[model samples]
Every structure is written in structure tokens, then in C-alpha cells.
Target: MRGTPLRGAIYGLLAAAIWGGMYVVSDVVLKVIPPFTLLTIRLILGAVVLLVIRWRTA
Candidate 1:
């Protein structure tokens, strides 16, 4: 009950942290991998992740 007020702030910090990590990883990956290839990989990975999440929920 006491933590209710802090939920939004916590989620905001988590989102920032996730995005910062992605930026660092993308910077390193793009040096060796082409942009289109990276985009394809990200799309595939996102699809797999979403599928797994959906399967689990069902």
C-alpha cells in the first residue's frame, strides 16, 4: 500500500534504463553489422519474444 505512489517513477526509471542499454548495444553492433541486417535481426527477435510472451499468457 505504501509503495503505490512510487510505481510510476519506478516504471519510468526502468524504461530509461532499458533504452540506454539498447543504445549502447546498438552502437557497438552497428560498427560490424549493416543497418538493414540489424533491423532484420531486431524484428525477428522481437517477434520471437512476443510470441513467447503470448504463449505463456495463454
Candidate 2:
């Protein structure tokens, strides 16, 4: 597909940034949120994000 490389690079960068920030964010968030509750919230948000991306691509 056209611009596939550019899209891939952008996605890679975004993933990397998220991964890098996750630890810092989680540390502060965990103080306010319980572990399991935080996990569930993350899972739900991730699923919603993936579904939106899939729907947009399709």
C-alpha cells in the first residue's frame, strides 16, 4: 500500500512512546487505583482503541 512505511514508522513511534511512558504513569496511577481495577481499565481501553482502529481501516 502507498505510504505503508511511513504509517508503520508512525505506529512504531507511538507504540514506543506509550511503552516508555506507561511505567511512569502506572507508578503514579497505582497509588490512586488498585492493581486489578487499573488492569481492567487498561484492557477495556485497549480493546476499544483496537476496535476503533479496525473499524476505521475496514
| Every candidate's lDDT | 0.94, 0.96
Clash count, candidate 1: 0
Please report how far candidate 1 places residue 39 from its true position, in Å.
0.3
Q: What lDDT tens digits, residue by residue, belong to model 2 across residues 1-58?
A: 5669889999999999999999999999999999999999989999999999999999
State the lDDT of candidate 1 residue by residue for 1-58, as single tens digits.
Answer: 5667589899899999999899889899999999999999989999999999999999
Q: How much lDDT does candidate 1 score?
A: 0.94
Cα error of candidate 2 at position 25, Å: 0.3
Clashing pairs in 2: none
In model 2, which regions exceed 4 Å deviation? 53-58
Task: Tell me the TM-score of model 1.
Answer: 0.68
Off by over 4 Å in 1: 1-11
| C-alpha-based local distance difference test score of model 2 | 0.96
